[model samples]
Target: MRIGVLGTGGMAAALGGAWARAGHEVFVGGRDGAAAEALARRIGGAGHGTPARAAEYGEVALLAVPAGAAPALAEEHAAALAGRTVVDCTNPLAPGPDGVMLTTRAGESVAGRIQAAAPGAHVVKAFNLVHASVWDLPAGAFGETPPAVPFCADDAHAAERVAGLITAMGWSPMPAGGLDRAVYVEATAAFVIGVWWAGGSPRLAFPEPAHPSA
Candidate 1:
């Protein structure tokens, strides 16, 4: 599988490196050509160039840029992204008067906005739950059981393909629902971020929700 990474930041390096180790071809791209080239070398990528070129170079494109910048980036590469699969790992968490909150507009997630920006691209929301450092750890660093990655995509084929990439990177893909549900996914990220800020374990609050079996 060929993957295009659209950022030179930590998240891009971590996930891109993992895929490269999994034997997938990775092409890293960024505004800073030097940084992109360096990351590609570090990850043993197939090549490096501008984001537009990377968008056109891969079967899957990973948008790991800041949430605030994603829409513009997506719009800029809309032509290259058409008929392509886009994996969104951006979280729009920002400080609020109350606590950690999603920076997105009501009912609009970063992924959703990206989809709107590049209407022809099949956008899938994923890889937003954990810190970039988590991806840097060796597989099974958490334990014998692999971690679960909850993702959402309206396109079934795109979901299946992204799930394959997620699996290749050593995670269990938990398909939450369609792109319509991505707002909730982004909320979950905010919730987990709040938990971490409070020094609580977010993992303890997942799956098998508490309810009376009546």
Candidate 2:
């Protein structure tokens, strides 16, 4: 698979590196040319260029920029991103007095905003729940079985393709209905982040369920 990553940040570096290691052709691009090039080299990506060019080069474009910057970047590359499967890995979280808060309009999610910015692109919301550093770990960052990655998107084909990619990366893919449900996922991130910051183990609440013998 050919993937284009838009950013020079941690998410871009980690996920892009993982994809490259999985034998995907990756191209990285960012506002900072040197940083983008450096990241591309580190990931052994096929190429590096401006964000617009990277969008054009991908069958699946990964928007790994900051959440606040995601919509603008998508809008700026709308033309190049048309009809492409664009994966949004941004979390619209802002620091609050106590913990993190999801920063969105009354009912909008960051993924929805990015989709609106590039109306022609199939934007899927994913990778927002885990920290970027987790991608640096082996296939299953947790213990034995890999944690499921929940995603939402309106385009079924595009969503399935992205889900397949996630499976290839050794994580379970959980389809979380259509695009509208993405807000819930984003909100969960805010809550989980708060728990993590508060020194609580959120994962404890989601223990492995016992299964009946077949």
Candidate 3:
């Protein structure tokens, strides 16, 4: 599989490196050409270049940029992404008066906005539930069974392809639902981040024995 990474941040480095290590052809692209080239070298990626060029180079385009920038970038590469698999790993969380909040408009998710911007792309929401450091480790390090990576997508072929890529990391790919379920997943990430910011483990509420995959 060929993957085009669209950022130079932690998520891009971590997941892109994992994919490259899994024998997928990876191309990195960013606003900063030097940084993109550096990351490409560090991750064993096949090449590096402008985001639009990278978008055109791969079967799958991994949108690892900041949530606020995702839609515009998708719009910029809409033509390249047409009929291709687009994997969205962004979480639109921001600080609010009360606490952490999902930054997207009510009833709309980050993935939905990306889908709207690149109408022809098969968008899938994933890799937002956990921190990038979690992906930095080997999948088997967690436990006997690899952790399940839950995701949502509107297109079946896109979902299956993305699920196969997720499984290549040795993790279980749990399909949550269609694109409509993305809002829930994003909200959960926001809540989970808020608890972590407050110095609490969101996982503490649900014991492993009862909620193994939570």
Q: Which number leads on lDDT?
A: 3
Q: Which lDDT value does model 2 have at 51?
A: 91
Ranking by lDDT: 3, 1, 2
Question: Which is the leading candidate under TM-score?
Answer: 3
| Candidate 3 residue-wise lDDT, 133-177, digit = tens | 988898688889888788999999999999999899988999999
Candidate 1 ranges beyond 4 A from true positions = 207-214
Whole-structure CA lDDT of model 1: 0.90
- Candidate closer to the true structure by lDDT (higher is better), 1 or 3: 3
- Prediction 1 TM-score vs. true: 0.94
**Candidate 3 positional error at 89, Å:** 0.4
Candidate 2, position 192, lDDT = 92
Clashing pairs in 2: none
Candidate ranking (TM-score, best to worst): 3, 2, 1
lDDT of 2 by residue, 117-167 (tens): 999999999888888898887786577888888999899889988998888
Tens digit of per-residue lDDT, candidate 1, span 4-49: 9999999999999988888898999899999999998988745899
Off by over 4 Å in 2: 208-214
Per-model TM-score versus the true fold? 0.94, 0.94, 0.95
